[model samples]
Target: MKLVVRVKLLPTPLQAAALEATLHACNEAATWAASVAFENETRRPLELRKHTYAEIRERWGLGAQAAQHAIKKTCDAYTTLKANLRNGRYGRPSSRRHARASGKPVVFRPQAAQPYDDRMLSWQHQAHTVSIWTTAGRLKGVAFTGQAEQLEVLAAHRKGESDLLFRDGKWFLIATCEIPEGDLNTHPDGFLGVDLGIVNIAATSDGERHSGRRINRKREQDRKLRSKLQKKNTKSAKRRAKKHAGKEARRNKDINHKISRRIVAEAERTGRGIALETLTGIRERARLRKPQRTTLHSWPFAQLGSFIAYKAKKAGVPVVYVDPAYTSQECSQCHHTARGNRPSQAVFACRVCGFVDHADHNASHNIRQRGWMVWVCGAQSTAPELNLIA
Candidate 1:
């Protein structure tokens, strides 16, 4: 598993200026290289190497590796643009043409974070300092501070390339570390089913529910705050609003992390895999009414699912996705399929079998059953067996 640990850097005034200058020069070179590469139709690094690598190095006064990394980054941007164009991802020519145009690329804060290899960056644990290469030459013993877990990762498994980023008036070194995968555990008791919904963020087949009412209330408050801020139309008001946005986002993400951790721990303790609904294109397919569209779009289902997946993987817990079609409408008790089975958002009652339960709870049970059929019964069936009804 690969994880990034961000450490705060405390550089001297001179070192900070040097770092900023180096980033400015590097990004300027990158923008120039990107324009040239786009014009000459050069997409490959090797192709750029043969044509313009040395020229850029000499012209920009950058070190050899720094120049090469910048050009490679530009090539990557162009590759993505071309791929998107080919796939018809962009609707407007203004967007497409702007992406492909040989215009000067925006250099926000001088693109100040340069990629660091082993040659360019080193860390000292005892002294709590890092040595990094800069345009002004070698910068050694730059002090840094981080949490214990972040420090531990740097001490142990820090590998590959790290990036030096300057943001919010502080310098940070983002280190990428590789951790070994865990052993897989057998789930003899079958899977723990999880149903994701708007009202309750997640409900397990075992009747555990994580309610989203608090999140919904917070979002509504944020929406009202944003509306008031937008009316001000002043620079400071906009800045304050942006700051609030970041705080809210971090809070939501932290909640998701905690929830995912608990869910994964439960699965691991019980020796069970997790079963989830495959919700690809759910927004477009659901055809939600106007009043519900905003809430639905802002639900963050994908983010929550991703958090669960990565945490599960780290703990060696298996996760499976079942087709979501009719999962809510189908009866978990007697396999009865009818739209009327789910008469309300919060309730599910089967007309045929007289079964009643919480809507999300019932859906989770159906999801677990489908997962069992796929994994154990050697059937690729998504639909519930209707034989019981007849």
Candidate 2:
């Protein structure tokens, strides 16, 4: 598995200017490339083939080498970008597209080697900035010095591995690292029955339920903040809008991590496979619940499920995604369907056999049954309730 860790990059005063310039340049290149792609598609009727690199440079009034380099860094990867768009895609392709030119610019494609000028100025973080052709040697820098961790490459070549993401006015570099694959049955755990819900988040068949306190509190907090911001007309309010939204997102992420960790740890301790819902069409279904749509959608079911799955994979624990159909309405003990079994959000009482139970607990039992059926029937198990083994 590849794990990406974002290390803080602290650049010197001069270095910061250069970094910002480079980022702008890259963004411009991306924007230009998008425009070029659209033009290429439009020009197809004129029997024009893709523009050559030389033609692109002259048309864009960019330096031969620089323009070529930008194309390499930007355009070639987005297959859907040019093709999916007609005339232009709805939103601004980028804030930097140039529409004044004709014909088409060459599509950008990254070469295996880093394309930049040598003798460019860069100061690596406390380490020597060494440049060599194609492949260069690097002595790894010291880790975690409390100071901002930064590396400046003056036209240096890299191993073609780093992925950069620009979002919310910041750039994140994802460096891939390999992790060893281990035995699936390396450690054994007992079974865990799970129940999924929008209101409560989820509950274990063992009577342990987790609250959706994070989302509830977030909505209330956002409501108050939005109300306050709406009343103001100043920079502080704008700053608050940006800052609070980011804070809210981070807070939500932290909560998800905690929830995932809890579930995974519980499964590990019990040494059992986890039973979760196959939340297919959940997003669509959430939309149908108009009144409580916010609450239903706010639940990070996908994130939690992902965490559980990956953790289970690493720890050799099995995970079963049981079918969620009728989990709440069907009686767990008798498998009898009734309108009165789950008459309300919290209450679950079976009308057919009078099996009174917590709604979540009843659903969890069915989830477990689904898993058992899978283990017994292998690939033939369609959902959470195969009965041959039980």
Candidate 3:
């Protein structure tokens, strides 16, 4: 499995200036390269390099490695754009958003991230410093800091290109670390089904709930404050808004990390596999009122699921995705499915059996049952002899 370890870079004023210049130059070169690629209908990095390599090196005064990376990044941007278009992320081809996206060459931000390979960047883990290439010259002994665990991981497993990015008036490097996975737990005792929701955040079949009430309140407050700032529309207000940007996202991500860690640890301890809902196309499929729409759209259900998945992987615990279509409506006790099963937001009352339970808890049990069936079927399919007997 590949993980990213991001560390904050501390540089002298001179070093910062050089880095700033280098980033700007690389992005400028990339923007020009994109235009050339668009005009010639050439997006392949190798073929596009033939047209823009010499010019970028000479015009931007960038080193050979820097020039190559800039061109590659440009091609990568176009590739991503093309994929988005194919996926209809911008809507139909007749839509204005789609037309606007496909009509022009891609542009790079002034402080866009630039990739640095071994030749362009080297780290001194023990010394807590890095020697990186800059347009001015090669910078040596530039300090960097990160969490102790992350620093250790970077030192041990860091490989491939690192991206230097400037964000929120800070310099950072995102390094890719390729960590080997351990043996997977194929034979599990049972599946720990987890139900993801906007209110509860995550509810497991084991009756554990990680509440999101406090976080949702904070988000509402932030939204209100942001609305006021936008209405004010002053320079200072704008500055403050920019300063606070991503704060909510960071908080949500941290909370998700803690919740996922606990869930994975519990599953590993019990020798249980994790079962989650297959939430693909949820956004498009969901319908909600105006007020509820924001809450639903802003919810980080996918991030939580992904975190649980990767953490479970690292712990050698297996994970399965179950179809969640009527899990909330189906009675876990009687297997009766109907819209009336959920008499309230949080309560599940079966119409036929008169059995009652927490809505999420009942749903999780249904998910657990489905997960077990899927696992059994899959196991049988893998063994043809067992399949023939069945």
Candidate 4:
């Protein structure tokens, strides 16, 4: 398993300026490479790689490894664009069009984020400092601070490369740490079903609910603030608004992290596998009304699910995804499926069997049952009421 740990970097003024210059030069070189790669009549890796890092190194005055990383980044961007076009994930090749488009000449923005390989980046565990190669030369003794646990991961399993990012006037090193995967605990007593939604972030089959009310309220507040700031049409107001937006995102991300941790911990403690609903392309298919579209799109269902999955993997807990079709409308008690089964957003009532429960909770139960059926009876099984051993 691979995870990224971000640590703050404290650099002297000189080091900071040099780092900024190096990032700018690297980005410029990358833009040049990307334009050349896309404008070429034949778009092959062999033709692209022919451009070479030595050319960028000589032109940009960058370290050999830094130059190589910059060219690789350009190639990666082009490759992704090509792949997306091939997979139909996107329409047409935008890079070619952009390269030929008339304007100020489209170029990659120098966002002050650069990738550093092992040769360009090194950490000093005892001194709590990092040495990174810069255009001016190698800058040593750039201090960094992080949590003890994060530092431990960096010291023990940090590998390959790390990203140097400049954000909000601060420098950060995002280290990728590779952790060993543990044997999954598959023979569980039961499954902990989780239904993810907009109003409630998650509802467990065990009757525990993690509400999204507060998160929704905060999002609304931020939206209104942004609107008012945009109306002002002032630079300072726009800057402040951007800052608030970032803060709101960080807060929501932290909440998701906490909620996922709790959910995974509960499954681990109870010796149960976690079951979640498959929600691929849910937003595109939802066909929500204009007013509700923003709210639905803002829900962090994907982020929450990913967090739960990675955390569960680290804990050796099995996580499964059940088909989401009719999970909300299907009755957990009576097995009746109908749109009218859920008369209200929060109420679930089965007309045939007179079984009633919280709408989300009922959906969670159905999800758990479906997961069991999928796992035990095989995915082809359509009997939702099949008997299973606990």
Candidate 5:
């Protein structure tokens, strides 16, 4: 599996200045290359380089490798933009959004991340330092720090290009690591069902509730603050908003990591496979009130599912995706399906057999049973009455 390990780079003032200058020169050269490509209708890196390479080297004072990377980066950006246009990401071709997006040449941010090949960057794992190429010159002994596990992975399995990015006045290097997966667990004892929801982010069949209350509260607070800042629209307010831009996302990602780690650990310990809902197109299918829309949209259910999957795979734990249709409305005990089974958001009461349980808990039980049926019988087993048969 391919994983990205990010480490913070701690550089001296001189090193930082050199890094900043390198990024600015590279991006400026890329911008000029993009303009040339746009005018000449050139999308291939080689063809675009034919037009801009010599000038980039002479004007930007970049080394041969850096010049090639900048040109390639510009071409990559255009390719991505073309793909987005084809996918209708900017809406229909007749729409103003599409027209505006398609009519302009792509521009690069001054401090946008630049990829570094092995020739351009060298790691000193034991010393926790790096020697990297910069526009001013080659920088040596630049320090970096990360978690112990990340450092271990970086030393043992890191490969491919590393991206140097400047964000919120901090420098970071994201290194790719190719970690080997463990042997697959062909025989699993059971399935650990995980039900995802807005209130409780994840509820497992083992009756563990990873609540999202705190997360939701914090998101709400951030939203309110953001609204106030936008209304004020002052320089200081904009600065504060920019500072808080990714705070919620970072916090959510951390929580998801912890939750996924625990879930995978428990399933591996008990020799159980992980079961998740196939929630594709959930955003379009879901309908909510005005205020609740933000909550639903902001929920990171997919992120949590992905985290569980990758961690499970690394540990040789099997994973299955089951149809989520009617899982919340169906009774886990009696297999009865009705709207009345779920009288409220949190409670599940079976009308047929008078069995009661937590709504999310019952849903997870249904998911677990469905996952088992799908695994053993080779059927979807999503219908409420499918489990009633011998």
Candidate 6:
């Protein structure tokens, strides 16, 4: 349950230069340290952090502790990435050749607002709350990552929280606060089921279907502007190019959050489980059709699933990811197997039983049934010798 809140780091022009400089120095230090570790032991020997920090400090003319933190940060990254690979949670670690991105590298945490890790980073919070990082015993600057107020704000808002600290160059303020959650078990009558779709974003088991059209006018306008910027020679193009990558991510995340909230609120009345497609090969299969590639990725199936999962958990409602097999093709009435049952985009009429229904509605029913089977019957379908979704 961790969310990054980005804020505007309102550093004065001079302060911005210094901050950026320090960050570059840190990144360079990390790169050098990584190089040293790899060269010293090509066999993946355990890293030794003892005096590397001291050595780096002497070479970079920074404080000794910064050097140590830098090397430690580099090692921690390599190790964590390695661990993630082992756990099947991430891809292979990056080679030095492919490394990119900005921001100062840290061992475990950033150095700015570093003292918060130490239980003391001076901060001011009267009205708009300021998170001040300390340097030479004076508070330095605040973080502006995104809705993320300075980490220090959390300390003031959440009393009895630990003071802030910076591990590498990152500031962190811990908050021990309790936000009210309305009683989740308040009602047990109303129930709603949802089915994620390809053309339509969602088709509820209850006849409500939501389309996945990008309807935010401002976002659409921004995208068009970005498209225009990407063509001609201008700084705005580069800036827009950079910002454009983030737009899709942010847009999809926000939309998923809203959609998940609506679905959760609908189901919370019954304390029931939400039904969702497992979404295994939706992308691959959908992409087999040229027009569907954009649609498939635009659906943000993973984010939608994740949003539903967390929201359902926080509420007393649970979510069920059914097998998603034949959800669209299987006849809801006679359990008939006929691809022709789904005659068109909006229609599903069973051939074997002569039953008729909207395609999305029939799919929704199958999803709900499969979810119930999984949740209540503890039924898991056997894996085939060769599994293919198409």
Query: Which candidate should be chosen as best, given TM-score against the real structure?
Result: 3
Question: Residue 12 of model 5: what lDDT?
Answer: 98
| Model 3, global lDDT | 0.87
- For model 2, the superposed segments whose C-alpha errors exceed 4 Å read 42-77, 80-160, 165-171, 186-190, 227-233, 287-291, 379-390
What CA root-mean-square deviation does each model show from the true structure?
6.7, 9.3, 5.7, 5.8, 5.9, 8.0
**In model 4, which runs have C-alpha deviations exceeding 4 angstroms?**
41-46, 86-106, 377-390
lDDT values of the candidates? Answer: 0.78, 0.55, 0.87, 0.79, 0.88, 0.57
- Name the Cα RMSD for model 4: 5.8
Tens-place lDDT digits, model 5, residues 99-148: 99989888999999999999999999999999999988899999999889
lDDT of 6 by residue, 1-390 (tens): 222222334555655555445545665677777666655642132344652666666666545445555566577666765565565454333543223311122233233321122233333444433543222223355543323343443433343323233332333344333223334442334335577766567788778777765543445566577678877758877865765666666776777778877888778765666777777777655424665564566557777777676566556665667777777889877888678887787899988889898888888888877777676655322211211000
Rank list by lDDT: 5, 3, 4, 1, 6, 2
TM-score of each: 0.88, 0.69, 0.96, 0.90, 0.91, 0.70
Clashing residue pairs in candidate 1 (N, C-alpha, C atoms within 3 angstroms): none
Q: Model 3 Cα displacement at 74 (Å)?
A: 1.1
Runs in model 5 deviating more than 4 A are 376-390
Q: Please report how far candidate 5 places residue 170 from its true position, in Å.
A: 1.0
The candidates, ranked best first by TM-score, are 3, 5, 4, 1, 6, 2
- Give the Å error, residue 11, model 2: 1.8
User: How big is the positional error of residue 192 in model 5, measured in Å on the Cα after superposition?
Assistant: 0.9
Stretches off by above 4 angstroms in model 3 are 379-390
**Model 4 residue 225 lDDT score:** 89
